[model samples]
Target: MFKAIATAAFASALLLGASTANAMIINGNFEDTATLDPTGLVNGNKLSNLATTGSSWDVFTQINGWTTASGAGIEVQTNRTLRSVDAHSGQHYIELDSHPRPNSNSSMEQEVALDAGKYELSFWFSPRNDDASSNGIEYSISDDLVSGFITGPSVSPLTSVGAWTLVKALFVVETAGNYTLAFAATGKQNTLGGFIDTVNITAVPIPAAGLLLPAGVALLGFASRRRKRA
Candidate 1:
């Protein structure tokens, strides 16, 4: 009886732990920015302000809590006029391809400390223009593996230039530590690649039903022991 009771308690605790996990990402919305100069440059990276600067800016050098993992970093677009594509949320979004010239290859990364568990990574992405095609964005956890990729629509403007599609990936960490989440652009490069916004990371829930297995095994062992003694 005591063994059965203890098993029940253990199962309850496991269920509780799974339900209480929280998000670990910071500045996931990409809404915050450092002050831009008169030339629309932030920390040497030119931010898109609807004016043709005839130069491209780096994204890693500007955004807080993020860094350029590869290529020339990324570009931040804020000009509503120049942007036929709208942001998924807030007033700004990030272009994976840096400007001056469109880059086919670019990457960005952020460092986050997380507890060991399953996590769901999600973000909203869209093409820069109707002509953008074959461009792909790949996501990785801890920079160790390429978890998944989102490619541009086979047909240009599948929905609209700015219409966003939510991309999601699930990953598990066996040990708790600081991990680097990275996004890289792949495939053919164009001025219009992919835009990212509203990135999020949250712990995946462990079903309460899974806890029953161990509890059932414990109870069965307890019952068998008692019957054997009789």
Candidate 2:
């Protein structure tokens, strides 16, 4: 009986340790709490804290487990709506000037780090209108802001001028550390605009010993009683 109890306790401890270890925030809210802001924000937009250099935007904050940011130049009123349960956000429309000669490229960007592993990154975004050929946004990721960068899970070309769209991308972190995430406005240069929201990066949870130990001990005792009867 004692051996069974001990075994159960040990198993429980292992499971608990695993759960506590795995459930962590690679990067929680973008308060710029860390002095490393690889992804700069738009000036005048709301920001939680200044990125690295103590420079902050005026368009982002943690409102009920969500971060919001927007970048709209002098043209038509535009903004980006972003929210995340873990640590992700998005936006809506950002109208840039005409294309080619008068192209208006208004955008916002962020940087985060992760351990080398398989991750599923997803976000909800939309352009001024659902016109992939004419209006949309482009996103890219790089190991370093200077070099060694990989493309996105899938660069979504704006096609539907709907209310909001959900886009997903899968990527592996070859090296753990900081990486730059860039969001750009793509398509015709005239009156360019868009929005992004609810971005999240989630990894599989490890098992928790606390949850397992009790079960193991109970099983062990049942086995021992049966053995004595036999």
Candidate 3:
């Protein structure tokens, strides 16, 4: 009976200690100012704003220019941010004559360097167009250069475009160090109306073996104290 109780107590102590490990934020707030940003986007990542129709996607001169909007839904809370770009309605993007509609032919992405470990990544999504289209968002993670279609999470393809919605996915890192993350939204050429917002990634805390050793010693001390009292 003593052995069983001690084992249970030690296990509980270990669990408690492990849960206390600090989960470091490797990449946050899409603050990386880089050249050729969107071209390096991950499989799923983006941010945008909404205020009725006819407005195009916002683009900040620099990532430092990003800020949160007021009275937005929870999905738009963190992972995604606002921008004023060429997003538009009526099968046309960017009021400029050269840009096409539906913004489907276009994609947006950003990059960040992150430490390795388990992580919970989530973001808000909303279609800029109410038209019948298969517009959807996707996220990708990579250790090498942010190129090609890196695998991660994605909103269901063939979606009901238009209106706002939140999407999230979890990923684990096998090794530690610098990596590239991207988000892309694509559709038929000249389709128009696509937007993304509030991209966020949080590291999942991993239990450390070293943390358990002290707890084990504490458990042994408690057991010894109980014996003396008895």
- List the candidates' TM-scores in order: 0.67, 0.43, 0.42
Q: Least accurate stretch of 10 residues (summed lDDT) in model 3?
A: 218-227
Question: Which 10 consecutive positions of candidate 2 have the poorest summed lDDT?
Answer: 218-227
Candidate 3 local lDDT, 54-94, one digit each (tens): 23223322233232121111121121223322211111121
Instruction: Report the C-alpha lDDT of model 2 over 1-230, residue by residue, as the tens digit.
Output: 21122433244334434222323223322333234323322343323333222332232222222222233332212222222111122212223322223535544445566777644444444444434444555655565222111111132222233334444444556678866555555555555445444445555233433232211011111011111221
lDDT of 1 at 211: 35
Model 1 misplaced regions, further than 4 Å = 1-22, 34-60, 79-83, 102-104, 131-134, 143-146, 155-160, 211-230
TM-score of 1: 0.67
Each model's number of backbone clashes?
A: 4, 44, 39
Q: CA shift at 35, candidate 3, in angstroms?
A: 15
Clashes of 3: 39
**Could you tell me how far off, in angstroms, the CA of residue 71 lies in candidate 3 after the best superposition?**
32
**Error of model 3, residue 31, in angstroms:** 11
RMSD of each: 16.4, 17.6, 17.6
The candidate that achieves the highest lDDT relative to the unseen native structure: 1
